[model samples]
Target: MSPELYITAGAALAAVVVVILLFKAVWRVAEPNEALIISGLGARRRGGDVDSLGFKIITGKGAAVMPGFQAARRLRLDTRAANLQVSCVTQQGIPVHIRGVVIYKVGDDFASIANAARRFLDQQDFMTSAIHELFTGHLRSIIGNLTIEDLILNRERLTSETRASAADEMSKLGLVVDSLQIQEIDDETGYIVNLGKPHAARVAATARIAQAQRDQEATEAEQVAAANMAAARRDARIKEAAYQAEIDRAQATSRQAGPLSEATARQEVVVQETRAAELEAQLAEQRLQSQVRKPADAKAYETRTLSQAERDARIAQAEGEAQATRTRGLADADAARALGLAQAEASQAKGLAQAQAISARAQALKDNQEAVIAQQLAERWPEIVEAGAKAFGGVDHMVVLNGAQGVEEMLAKALTLGGAGLGLARVLLNGNTPNDSNSENGLKATESRE
Candidate 1:
């Protein structure tokens, strides 16, 4: 194991390292997302009947390219985006703004790779700009054929149709569209906003009607409940009155029975006393009996006479009262009938006077509408000025460029809008016919409608 054996081992290791470096320098790898385009010298590829394409495209593998005779270039096969912002006019002559993105990549087939390599091998950085221009023109064309509604609601149609439109062109450029999306559309006019207003108003009207119906139903229910409570109160009062009448009648009966019972009890006592006297003294019995009998008969006769007189008096008084009530009823009926006729006549005369006055006033107004307006405006001038001044209530700042003159002009302009009410009043007073004569007063009428 001396110096000669060591020299032999060192030479073998040097040869192996040189061969590995040479292999690394000659071999080129194409990544999964890229294709290597090899041109010059034996780089031609042969397919079935067609001859070689004059170049070789290697994808996802390694190939040997001679250092001087062959040139290898990479064409990326990864996806790319081309943004399109186009202001285009639709088929309906409507201007629209569209923003979208087109996702594209180089085709995977050999033929597509050949086409791409031939054009983009040296200019891969500008590929997106070229696609952007291509797709921008295509989008304009596509948008020109479809309407705004189609663009908004039928985006899938737009996509498919756009892809179909640019299919041949993209194939020539060796591009395949993975997705074409229309992201935004801006309409300059407010057609879409006004479109839903009618439906919204109808829905609002229906809601209001439903709310009113519910309120009316609630009000009716409340009224019915109030009626029921009042009826209960009335019935309770009637029942109490009936019970009170029964109590009063019972009390009157008790009061009437007291005097009769007292009279009967005194008569019984007198009879007992007479009987006792008869038993005690037989001699005086006859005398006492006569005296008691005579006095009792006299008292009885007086009571009978008084009762007959009182009955006669009550009968006469009742008869007189009935006669007076009947006379008064007859007189009242006659008086009421006369009063009714008088009132009817008075009402008729009053109605005729009112009708005449209304006719006269109407004639005057039709003849002198200007006078009527002048009178109304004169009466309500202060209120009109106050209402016009309310327009600036929310203003926190005021800038007058022309001092008092500017203030006057601003005030006049603001009052003009509020003067719509005055215009409406004049329109009402006149029969839609305006008379423009110079006012006797210095004030001039700047606005008038005829």
Candidate 2:
């Protein structure tokens, strides 16, 4: 066993059988969403397909396929979906029931993946019921030209009427309808909630007529503010009854004036006691005519002058005794002178009958000179009213100083005291008595024996 150690163990057993036949003639592997379509006999050309179906599409890469001339297949590009249930007829021929969905893929341009791998490769589970019986006869000729409001609000005219009715039978099965969706539409009558109900009842009757005209203008402004508060309470009760009657007429004129000035001061004290009793009855009638008629007219003028001097001495002693007794001496002196002339004619007839009764009482006082001056003014009318009462006898409190010229100067000093008692009765009728001789005096004693 030596020829150099059997040539080094026969070259290590021929390099371990050429590494086990080069790992069984070239190894390979690829996966992850697949693409391993190795064709028969030496497949290789990728990308832009070249010739015969002798191919190679090892996606994520792996190779070593020689087993009996090499061949393999697995082509699934991924995205796909199709659910379409349709029963249709429209164009006013009604009869419709449809529900749809169709999203497709497996055509990233490998010539639309070799035309969907020659029509679904091998009936890929009936490819969604053969695309829902070829889209239910193309959705009944696209709802026969459209009506149901152009299939509910015209979605771009229902996708241009579904691409003008399935674009020539999906281009004879090349297929590219990426989406054709219409989830539901099943109407037999009740049109669409009676189209909208009349415009919502005209917007609810215009909001109830604007709320009844704002409640009648708030009740006529609250009754005109209660009639202006009852006319201001009747003008404040007529100005408080005219200020209480002007305070009761100024308290009744101040109570009459105080009893009219005390009745004019008691009528001036009874007119000063009736003028002092008329001056005491004119001083007692002038003291009874000055002590009883001037002493009885001086004793009747001394007893008539001693009775006419004793009758003239008895006629001179009887004529001297009749001539002394006549002795024949001339017939006795003629009878004594006829008896002394008959006694001197009887004493001159008694002194002419007493001087004719005093000249017939002075011719009846000068023929009744106003009845002797009204009987001497009625016996000296109380001494001419007491010299007119001495001019109010110095009036004690008389204030009649000048009102009416002091009562007309006290009535002209009481008529000048009756003209001084008629000038003292004309000086006692012009003389008389005083100391008579034989005039038999007194009542004027024969005017002093003139």
Candidate 3:
């Protein structure tokens, strides 16, 4: 029973394995990056007549291929890259060798798939060589139309030119170019290098100039910031010093407060004591005035009154004696005058004889006025000396520095002043002499009395 069962199971398992192998061969699956190109028989046509290739294209799914009746081939649609090297001349007629890479993929559309399948299905490994050869001619054309400057710097112009030069050719190959990159440009005559030299030098110089300016501005800003920092530090130090000074002053004032207060209190006590002393002295003075001065003043007044009355009595007694003497003298003069009148008649005859002699002497004196003035000066010499001595009357003390000589000089100066008066008298006497000689004699006597 086990042998029969084992043989049956073995046969069934082999059949299933063969069927699976057969199904895998007929049922062709297209991967994400590939397309199934089925042709030969019962294959549906796709795209229009212009692009139809009597084949059916399937992508991203499976299709039943009838083995001999219909044949299916896998066409790769993945990206492929090709290296390109070309010798070309730029629009500026500069010869250059360019090296580049072109990235491309088979088209996803049915028409493009059919075209690629027809061309590359048998030679999938030769795709890169085909693309490289094709792109090489297109790159030459592109470089011929563009300047080295555009190729080197203007990437957009380079890309656009590449697209314009290769688009139709790539479409015929059923390939889409994702990118064309120019990797290197070798200038045989150094045309491209020389062309950029001036611009490069100018740009380098401008960059250096800008860098220098920026450096200078940065230095100035740094210096200004340092100055500001120094100023801030100095201000802070000044404020700190001022605050310290204020603190010291406050401390000193606080330390002295107690002593100053005590001194003020002592001064107030002294002032109060002084006021009390002054009030006591004033009270003493008032007591002295009331107890002593009033009584002393009254006693002195009484003494002065008694002395005045005694002096008045003595003056009245002396006045009465003077009146009695004057009355007796008048009586004696009346008697003498009566006796002189009897003798006056006898003297009248003698006076007439004396007048004749005096007239002769007056004529001689008038004839010599100098001799008259000299005689008069001799007669008034004693009176002149007395008048000169009166100059010293009010002096309390006489101190002559030159001793007796000084006293003599002073007396001489006083006598000189008296002589000046004598000259004046002489001038008066001279005017009076012609009119009245007796009047001149009387003026001389008055001068002596003065």
lDDT of 1: 0.76
- All predictions: root-mean-square deviation over Cα? 53.3, 27.6, 20.0
| lDDT tens digits, residue span 257-344, model 1 | 8997898899899989877654544544444346443554565566567667989997896688567545544666677666555545
lDDT of 2 by residue, 270-305 (tens): 666565544544544455345433443444344445
Please give the ranking of all candidate structures by TM-score, highest first, separated by commas.
Answer: 3, 1, 2
**Cand. 3 TM to true fold:** 0.58
The better-scoring model by TM-score among 2 and 3 is 3
Question: Highest TM-score, which number?
Answer: 3
Off by over 4 Å in 2: 1-32, 41-64, 71-74, 80-90, 93-101, 105-116, 120-137, 140-142, 145-150, 153-180, 183-450
- How many clashing pairs per prediction, in order? 0, 3, 0
Instruction: Give the Cα error of residue 228 in candidate 1, in Å.
Output: 24
- Model 2, residue 226: distance off in Å is 26
Deviation (Å) of 88 in candidate 3: 1.2
Q: How accurate locally, in lDDT, is each candidate?
A: 0.76, 0.59, 0.77
